[model samples]
Target: MDLELKGKVAIVTGASQGIGKAAALRLAAEGARVVIAARGRELLDRVAQEIRAAGGSVAAVPADVSRAEDCARLVAEAVKAFGRLDILVNNAGTSATGAFESVTDELWQADFELKLFAAIRLARLALPHMNRQGGGRIVNITNIGAKQPRAKSMPTTVTRAAGLAFTKALSKEFAPQQILVNSICIGSVRAGQHEAKAAKAGVALEQYYANLAKDIPLGRVGRAEEVANAIAFLASGAASFITGSSINLDGGASAVL
Candidate 1:
């Protein structure tokens, strides 16, 4: 299906790798001018080069989304590069889980900063631009833990829950403006963090991923490209009527949904 994304301008956060990278590539492939942001300058440039090499319009800006200024700068740079912003993919975050008592205030703050505040700041900055254009899309990347909170999943779940609420409320408030908002409730997908964890545990990467897939009803983990395809749809004109909803990308692993 044609997403009708050609000539659109998009900003994707944490876009140096994983789902973010996939989203960037997919959007660029659909003929959107993509501005990719991440804290790692080297990786960010590499992604930009990959996009450019494929003849996709792109710009890379190294940014740490946890900082308010960085979030502001990312949006600004995107607009400056592309002349407008039509889609904002809030995908910059990390998983932080621990026993309730073992979790520190610092850790909580850090998680909120990286996950919650980053999305909040980016949305706040991007909404005005969307409103002026009369419509836009905001696709937030969250995990299934947000809906089915498990024991020992502290700060991450809490913030994701907030993200769901934020998506719903923002969608309602912006529906009139055609600025749709939604989220992807992702389960385990192949990613760098998982690879690192497997290496740290002295387990073969394939075995580690197999263990994760066992719990999923599909008997396999998801792929970053799958998530990105959904994100690209959500950010496209084809998804004009989809708003204030969360799609489960968990391969039937999430029981709450």
Candidate 2:
């Protein structure tokens, strides 16, 4: 499983921690030069240094994805550093859980700005560069809530649903140019914010994760690396024929297709 990714370049957003960090390390492990982006400069730089310490090629670019300028700068910096971009993983996002009536217009708009608009802007910027190169890959990290639609998850569910639609639409648009676009819907994963939440709950970390994992048929939440593995496949030549598809990596938490 060479992944045939040697020398290929990838841009991973939200790469400071959580699944984004996992994806960045995995891509670098597979021999792809990686550009890690996030708003936290120190955290992003630390992750980049970890990759380099493992003998992987990586550069850190601190930028907020919600801004159009940052999105363009991210891609531009990747190209400038690596010469070409082969993959884009839109993983930066924010979560808001509230009833439909409780969620304000500002809340919805802010969530969209972080999750949906960022992906849209990055895809738009990457399209011409990918088209010029003849082909590329884009993997959007959405959520299972997009398909399931929980009542308390009004904002996240609505925005993630739109993100799925965006992935599908981009897939069709990029197909002719050989740029494959796909998405991965995440389930519960023990990382970053989740760990912080667990700590705040005053619960034993292992027990908290175990309790959370009990809901899935697989009897556990997914690992960040597991989701990253799927992203790697979608980004690789092995998935050349795959586009406009949504894959779930939720340890059987998502019952829907």
Candidate 3:
């Protein structure tokens, strides 16, 4: 079924690779004019080129979302390029994991800056435009750890929990304006980070991924495209009634309800 997203404009952060790249491609494929953002120019350009090659409308913008100025610039550039912003996907973040004692205040601050504050800043910038347009969608790519924290999960878990709260609060505040907000809580997905970890462990990428899936109920890790599909759905008219909800795209890996 069509998502009825044609002509809509979307800004996807951290679109250089992983779930962000997949979400950008999915949005473009659904006929949304997409502005893809990341800190790396080369990979961002490559993703944009790939989308263009597939006849998808996409533009690459390099920005570090942790910076307030960069967040404002990203939204401005998207409006300048596409004339309006209908979707904002806050997917740019780092997985800073460590024991509580090992995580420094700097690490905690950095995690909140990128994962929480970026989304907060972008939403603050985009909400008025969305209100003016009569409606819009914001999808925050958080993780299942936000809902179910394990041992040794520091800054990431704390910051992601904040993100979950942010998602809910925004959903409530904007519903009156028809601005829907939600989150996709992720689990283990096959992405660039996993590849790096595999290489670091001196194991084949496939083996590393297999090890990751052993504990998941599905017997395998999820694909980036799988997460992207959920992102697109939340940003589409198809999810008109889905505000204030956190959908766990973890293939049943999350133990909490």
Report the lDDT tens digits of candidate 1 across residue range 154-225.
Answer: 989999999999999999999999999999999999998798889989999999999999999999989999
Please identify which of the two predictions, 2 or 3, would achieve the higher TM-score against the true structure. Answer: 3
Rate residue 21 of model 3 by lDDT: 97
Runs of candidate 3 with Cα error greater than 4 angstroms are: none
Q: What's the lDDT of the predicted structure labeled candidate 1?
A: 0.94
- Better TM-score candidate (1, 2): 1
As a TM-score, model 3 comes out at 0.98
TM-score of each: 0.99, 0.97, 0.98
Q: Order the numbered candidates by TM-score, best leading.
A: 1, 3, 2
Tell me the deviation in Å of residue 190 in model 2: 1.3
Tell me how far the alpha carbon of residue 114 in candidate 2 is from the true structure, in angstroms, after superposition.
0.6
RMSD in order of candidates: 0.7, 1.1, 0.7
Q: Return the clash pairs for model 3, or none.
A: none
lDDT per residue for candidate 3 within 1-257, as digits (tens), equals 88989999999999999999999999999999999999999999999999999999987899999999999999999999988999999999867899889999899899999999999999999998899999999999998999998999988998999999999999999999999999999999999888888888899999998898988999999999999999999999899999999999888999987
